[model samples]
Target: MARGAIPPLPVWAGEALDLITDMPSAEDLVTAMATQAEGALIRAGRR
Candidate 1:
């Protein structure tokens, strides 16, 4: 594969491999950020 190009997964194993390894999506990032913020807020409240 060319540099920065993602290789196509074999059709038969695509589903399985995708579950094992995949890049994070935008929603994943937002969710993670929100989760961290919530944790920080909770800790601040406890202080």
Candidate 2:
């Protein structure tokens, strides 16, 4: 991969890449994932 270039990805992987690119920042992604995990854990009664 070159600087600032997105390497080709498989269809499923590309979809995830799209979502990542749409995020405003890496911190936002981490926070969102953490919140989701917490929600899932709560729902599963593991939290």
> Each model's TM-score, in the order given?
0.48, 0.51
lDDT of 1: 0.81
C-alpha root-mean-square deviation, each candidate? 7.2, 10.3
lDDT of 2 by residue, 1-47 (tens): 57977667586698999997887897887999999999999999999
Q: Candidate 2 local accuracy as lDDT?
A: 0.87
lDDT of each: 0.81, 0.87
Candidate 1: residue 2 lDDT (0-100): 78
- After superposing candidate 2 on the true structure, give the runs of residues whose Cα lies further than 4 Å from its correct spot: 1-22
Which residue pairs in candidate 2 collide? none
lDDT of 1 by residue, 1-47 (tens): 57978667685488777876787888898999999999998989952
Clashes of each: 0, 0
